[model samples]
Target: MIWCFLTPVLGAVVAEQYLGRVKTILYSAAIYGGGLAILVLSSLPAVQETVISLPGLLLSLFLIGVGTGGIKANVSPLLAEQCTSPGQVIRLLKSGETVIIDRELTVQRVFATYFLFINAGCLAALASVEIEQSYGFSAAFAIPMTVFIIGFIALMTSKDQYNSSAPDGSIIPSVLHALGITIKHKGNLNCTRPALEPVESRYQEYPWTNSFIDDLQTALSASKVFLLYPFYWAAFSQLLTNFISQAATMQTHGIPNDILPYMNPITTLFLLPLLDRLIFPTVRNLGYPVHHFPRITAGFMVCALAMLYAAFFQRTIYVSPPCYDHPRSPTCMHGQVPNDVSVLLQVPAYILVASSECLASVAGLEYAYANAPKSMRSLIMALYLSTVSVGTFLAMAVLPLTVDPKITWMYIVLAMAVFGAGAALWSVPVQRKEAG
Candidate 1:
């Protein structure tokens, strides 16, 4: 996971320094497809028996990671580039009404749409579990490989139609240059100094524009806000591992154990449209501020609530199971008569987390791009996305508590941690104001 998260920074560096976004993405498609092909081959029973080497599996994963890295670093910036308007535009409606098109909201909508399609892809991927069960692992792996091929073809056909950013050389030299200047004049660099160099004069020695410096400050400020995100992602990451375990302890009523994780994406699919179309617009109409901070803070609280519910769900499962005290016993496994609680009851928790994604995850994407300087957008976005890996790392510390009986406590502790992080996140702007 760390490799998966960190590889994108390398891609971002390559994109920002050498090849442009379009060519980088095109290059990634081939690598990504080849990796998937390798994965498909690895799943074959014949290959599994002899030819499936650990090095081969690791290499395939590495290729996939790099390919995803290039695509991940560029895709968001590319989508955001399509919305050329940077501020609100007032438009007269044909029906004699008026609407203000806010650029931030427009960007938010683009990300929402992006997430919708992302989850739509997830829905398709989730179906592959059933394919693996029904047909074979090769069939399941082949599905994504095929999709990657189609995507590669589509990208190639439309290569000329997309917007691309040229690599402006590496960011490292620029950073070192700034640091050298900062250290050289450390004693004299005061904002209120009367003899301070004019913005143009500063540029001559700095090797960067005044605007770049100012924007870098903004990017740094935004990056501080994201430091809290690992807690949020850690709480959310539960859905991938522990939440499914929780569901396995409950009555699925004929649903597959793997099927429950799909609820997150499925719920997200519905909530995106609800928030984008109805809920958010109504709030705006009512003269409320619908900015990123408020949305993200609310998301954290919602996520905390979701985990609280999960903790309770796990507690209930402990008491009602066939194994009783032995939560990990084979009698408690799936295909056995599940615990007294119905898996459908877990829906609210899924919905809450889904709302968190709409409020926090999608907003995080918009916040990363909207707040970042143009020169550092991909790097900043990569930093934001890496929070997932950070959170996963944090979860590793609590791995011992992830087992059956201690799992309830793990959820409780995580929920509390997230709530605290959310509150801290909410206080950042306040702290900034105080510092200013």
Candidate 2:
């Protein structure tokens, strides 16, 4: 999983320096399809009986991770780049009120819609799980493999339709050079020393313009906003790990414990359109637009609330009958008898976390794209995506507390940590500047 997140950094550089977004996505899809094909073949009964299947499965997963990283880093920025308008435009509403359509708002809605489709696609997970259970692992793997083949064909037919940026020269050396210049000038980026100095007096010619410096500053400022994301992601990670474990301790009524996490995507599917079509428009019409930072802060708060609820829910499970405080007790047959609590009760927490994804996760994508320098969009996005890897590490650090008894404290700590991060985000001067 960490490799899945980290590979995007390299993928982004590849996208920026050599292959354009469309080609990168195509190549990545090809690699991903190959992995899926390998997976499907490896799951066949004959191969499953052999040691080769294990290595094949591992290799497939690694290839899939690499492909996923490449796709993730490029796709969102590609979508954003397709939007023609980059500035505000005045338009008349049906109600005869003239209003300014902000490109930032359009980007936000685009990302929200993008996220909606992503989750809709995630419904395949539930379907695949059922297929694996009923048909076979090979059949389950074959489904997505077939879908990817079709999707790749569609992309191939429509390749020229996308608005793609050509690979500019690599930005890494330029960024490093600019940073050195900034440090030499005692952190003053506005100085014209690069342009004004004689060529003979300097070790190298300044290849970047003054505008490039401005863009670099914007990218750096945007990077600062991403610092809080790891905490939010760390809290969100519980949905996959500890949340499933919590469900296992409760009465699932013959349902799979892992199935409940799908509620996050299910709730997101319902909420995205409502937020995009209704809530945001209504709030904007009321003269209070929820900008990206406040919207993300709201997401952080929602995540914290989910954690708080989970903490209380964990406490309830601990105090519930049969196992009482220790669900794994041998007296209760070592988790054979779960607590009397119904697993359906976990739905609200999942819903809250889903809401946070709509708010924080989608908005973070929009923020990254909108604020990034045109040339560095993929790089900035990869940095934003890396937060998930960092958050995974944070979750791993707390794995010791994921066991019974300590789990409740884990939730509490996560809640406090996320809320504190959100508060810090809100207090950021740039957030205030944007809000004002």
Candidate 3:
């Protein structure tokens, strides 16, 4: 998971400098397909006992991580780049009335749709779970491998239809040189602006313009906004790891423990259209605009609430039945049985997390793309994605506390941490600046 998040930093640079977006995605997909194939083969019953199995599985995971990183860094930027319209336009309708179209809203909708399909794809996890339960791991892995191949083939056949940007020859050196000049001038960014520099000065050594400096500043501001995201993601990450363990300690009633996590994607799928078609429009018409900062702040609060509920729910599990504080106690048939609490009760937490993703995650994507310099869009997106790596590391640091008695406290701490992050994000001066 860390690799999945971290490799994107380098992957974005590669996409921008060497392979334009389309080719990067194609190469990444090929590598990902290869990894999935190896994963399928290694999971087969015949191969599981062989010496090659573990190494193959490890290598496959690494390739999958690298491939996912490349795809993640480029796909959203590429999707948004497909819209060629101006930011705002005045047009005449069929009824001879004039109307103004806001491309920012269009981009927001595009991202919402993009995020919707992402969750829709995640619904395949539900299918995988069922397959794993019914047909074993080999068949389960094979399904996605096959689907990936189909998707790759489709993309390859239609590659010429997409709009792609050419590599903007490396900008890192110019950025570094500009920053060096800024520092030399006592932290004045304007010192590097082309109009302000002397003819023979080092600033003139580069070809960057005043607008590039402004864009660089804007990108830096966006990065500051992203600082809070790691805390948000750290709390959200529990859904993938600790939440499954929580389910195992509850009464599943013949349901698979892993199945509950699908509620997240299900909730996202249900809510995305609702937000796009109804809620956002209704709210805007009612004279309240939900901008990125507010939306993300709301998401943070909602995630905190989810964690708070999980904490109480964990407490409820501890106090519940044949084995208080330890659902898997030896007294209860040596950990063979769970407590009386129903695992289905976890659905609400999943719903809240999904709601948070709708707000924070989608808004983050739009915000990053909207604010990023044209040449640095993928790089900024990768920086935004690296927050997930930070969040995962945070989760790992607290992982030892995920044990029986300490689990409830862990949730409580996470709730506090996320709420603090939201408060900090809301209080940031940029939020008020954006509002103004």
Candidate 4:
């Protein structure tokens, strides 16, 4: 959240003082890229012990997070403003319109995921060995920085296509204009029919007071729909962040640190489209009546199942490191499947988790954007992401609690997964006749 403390305010200064959005993206990317580079360089064990103390490392992480936070938050709004039509705005608007389930965006993202996620999964499969043998964490991050630089170069080279106005081409004027339109609308309504009586007279008849009476008088009341979405997403945010580490810890008995990479790949790939070709057409078919809730519910159901699968893994394999944790020793931290139970038993659980992730997360992106209102799209999108932040925050908070019942976190994930499924199932009927 503090990302705004730097990016919008500081970036606004940078834009005014010397550069603009193009420069902002470039420099933001560079700063972010540079931070990643520094992080990688300093992660070298020798360098870490000497130069990067834990506090210093955390501070660097915070700085980097702040820079990227502002960049990403502002970038999409900038892009939308540059589009030529309300068609683009409409499309962006449509992205947030729960009444119009966004199939095109859904198709685009799913297709992108088919390629990107699988490749990411594949790379993740090889990541552990690569990290150990290559430059470790620093080198891992450096690789992405190189990619970011290339990305910056590509963005710079690309020609600008759309030249749309920014909500009236000026923030102050735009805000005033919007507010004026709203006020004029209210005045028109009241003037046409004074049977409405003086609202102030009504207030006088039933007056309620507060310390901030003046402020309350001026403010607009919020819509009820705004309350619904954040609730749905909050459930989601809790799931992945809380569950993943717990699943990992429970399954780690016989698992080699190196082989652990495959666990996630196994899980995620299982959830993703088995074939890239199937994704677009499947989504295209869903475009018929915009049955978004059903799709979202299906995703949630899968997520719930994933946690049950995890519960099984946690309950069974969470004890007595029998082998793998002691690679050189005779005893292994293995499970109770067979006399010759190999490390491979963990694959089922990983596959289960991955399947759940694909169902929950990908749809979640589509759901969040589709469900939000137009003017608040970016903020709502951030709100969707913030759920993950909340979930991760919950996870970190819950991590230490494992020492208690040691079984509580398992049930917690199960509850989130179940609650998510229930919520998604309930929301389905709302959009059944609606566009989204």
Candidate 5:
């Protein structure tokens, strides 16, 4: 289940206003890491009976949710905290800041964040299969705990690279004020607050429109940059999540059965550094800023093509039926075939998927942070991540509406990409003007 973005962004705003984002990330990471440990210890295994297992699974999900809430709520503010001035930020955006863009540094951060994902995923990918294959259920149950401890150690050793403070006074009131404005008008079909927190610290009277539709139209239409924005982030996230269950996975033939899931982790681990160090910088360096939308658009479309490859991979490649020991197996025809697709074809599909990830994922993060209002970095990041959650929910939700098989779940994702691309194109003119 998705949690709203407001909570963590609010926390970051308050803490940065009164405390600091560096401290926020430290505290955020701690709380999130703590939740990971809980999920590790308590999450139910595949064998657990439904009556006794559902609650634990839900609880584990809830704990992971807590960490997501914490990390996303503050990460943008934490990164932005490292910067000096707005003018310097603009220049740094073009030049590429050492903190965000250095090859070694980028690799390290990607390893820290993404490798953390892979290693954690390995619990499901490798350890579970391992436990099931060799040690049995209890060992699989225990694997996540071991992995969590490693994560804890990794987080503990990671240095505090971000060290900056709130500019002067409050970021709290504008955030709170924005929330109040949002909520007070939430049910009002036609209400709009023209005065979004003023440039000055003090609040000023803004134009409050009675028609919400008119106000929304004004915002998108008037804000040309956002209106014209391309569909890159929307498409990238949609593709990855839409095909979450599908992968170009190879078999663990002649090896222990339990380690098959580990293939994904291993493959991911090997590719991430290559991506961060070589592919990402090359793409970013090739006529960025001016060709920003097009670069990301190419990434989005490539990812779509990868999904098509995965679908084909799943369909083709003749997998022979399993030989049942039972003489009267009640026609176990489907059971005879391999549940997974062949690994020989999985490599290139994953390469395509991973490369697309490198092209768009982190670059988009940097892009969003660059575009946000000075004080609303964390909020924007939360919203950006929230789109992933929203896009996922939409995929499931649209199944009933389009009922046509031609318009499958992935089609919704494709459609969203198209919409986002249109929006981005519309918004670019305005954004460039604002930047200029």
Candidate 6:
């Protein structure tokens, strides 16, 4: 998993220094397709019987991870670049009210749409579990392999539609060269001060432009904002790990245990359209600015509320009949077969987390791109994505509480931790004057 997150930094470097976004995406997609094919073949009964090996499985995963990281880093910025508008615009509504169509907000909407389709793909992938149970793992793997191949072909068809940039040839070395110039001019100690302006002689001696220095400042500020993201992601990561464990201790009635996980995406699919078309526009028309930080802060609180609900749900699961003190007991193990409370009860938590995604997840993507220098979009976005991995690592601090009755306390602690992180994030200064 760390490898999955780490590879994007390399992808960002390659994209910015060697290949532009379009070529990088195409090349990565091909690599990804090849790796998926290898995975599909490896999972086959015939291959398993003949010569399945852990090394082969690991190699496929590594290849896929690298390719995926490349795609994840570049694609959002590429899609966002499609919107030519760089600032907010005012339009007269049919209701005789004025509405501000904000570029940052528009980028947020684009990312929301992007995630909506991404979740749609997830919904389809969840369906593959049915295939895995009946037709076998080979067939299940084939489904995603086929889907990725089709997506690659579709991307190829639209190649001419995208805006592309040439690689600037190794950005880090250039940054180092500029930094050396600054250090020589300003002295090493004063270079770290926020108020220190770049010495004019340094710009003349080095190729560093005023715009580059200013943009670097913006990029650094954005990176600091990204540092706060891991808390929200750490809280969100529970849906993928611990929340699934929580679902296993509840009654599913006739539903498959795996189906409950789909609720997050399903709720996201429903809520995104409502937020984009109605709520946001209405709020803007009412003379409120839906700034990224405030929206993200709200998202953090919403996620904290979701965790609060999960804490209560876990408490209920602990006290409920069949499971009683031991949710992992022999009878309680199947969850579908023997459990006290209905799984339907987990719906509120899923819906609340989904709401947070609309606010927090989309806001993070927009904030990364909108705040970054055009040259640093993929790199900055990769840094933002890296927060999830960081948050996951941070979550290890609470690993001891992942079991049984202790899980309730775990959710409560995470709720407070995430909420506190959100408050801290809200206090961090943003470069709005620089942004303007």
lDDT: which candidate is best? Answer: 3
lDDT of 2 by residue, 270-384 (tens): 9999998999889978999678888899999999999999999899999999898888567677658998899988999999999999999988888888778888899899999
Q: TM-score winner among the candidates?
A: 2
Each model's lDDT comes to 0.79, 0.86, 0.87, 0.46, 0.47, 0.81
lDDT of 1 by residue, 1-436 (tens): 6677877787777777778778888898789888888888887887888755555677789899999888888899889887876577999999989988777777788899998998999888877888988999899989889988998999999988876666778565775555455566762333212235546455344455666656656766788988999999889988888777777767778887677778889999888899889998899879886778888889999999998998887888878757654554775564466667788878888888988988888888888887877777788788888888899888877789887678888889989989999899866752131100
**What are the models' TM-scores?**
0.88, 0.92, 0.92, 0.60, 0.60, 0.89
Alpha-carbon shift of residue 431 in model 2 (angstroms): 8.0
| Residue-by-residue lDDT tens digits, candidate 4, 316-372 | 444334332222222333433222223445456445545545555555545544443
List model 5 lDDT by residue over 176-290, tens digit each: 4444555676643232344344345235554333343343333333234332223333433433343333321224344433333344456556666665567645755784432
Name the TM-score of candidate 3.
Answer: 0.92
lDDT of 3 by residue, 1-436 (tens): 8899998877788788888889889999898999999999999999998999999999999999989989999999998898877868999999999997777788888899999988999887778877998999999999989989999999999988888788776577777788888888898888888778755684445588788898888877778888889999999999989999999899999987777888999999999899989999899889998688888888999999999999989999999987779888777779988888998889899999999999999988888888788888999999999999999888776787898889999998899999999999866554122310
Q: Residue 379 CA error for candidate 6 (Å)?
A: 0.3
Clashing pairs in 6: none
After superposing candidate 5 on the true structure, give the runs of residues whose Cα lies further than 4 Å from its correct spot: 1-19, 26-30, 33-37, 40-57, 76-80, 83-162, 167-292, 311-335, 338-343, 397-436
lDDT score, candidate 4: 0.46
* Candidates' RMSD to native: 4.2, 2.9, 2.7, 9.5, 8.5, 3.9
Judge candidate 1 against the unseen true structure and give its global Cα lDDT, from 0 to 1.
Answer: 0.79
> lDDT ranking from best to worst?
3, 2, 6, 1, 5, 4
Evaluate residue 40 in candidate 1 and report its C-alpha lDDT on the 0 to 100 scale. Answer: 84
Q: C-alpha displacement of 156 in model 3, angstroms?
A: 1.7
In model 6, what is the error at residue 96, expressed in angstroms? 16
Off by over 4 Å in 1: 90-100, 176-204, 330-338, 429-436
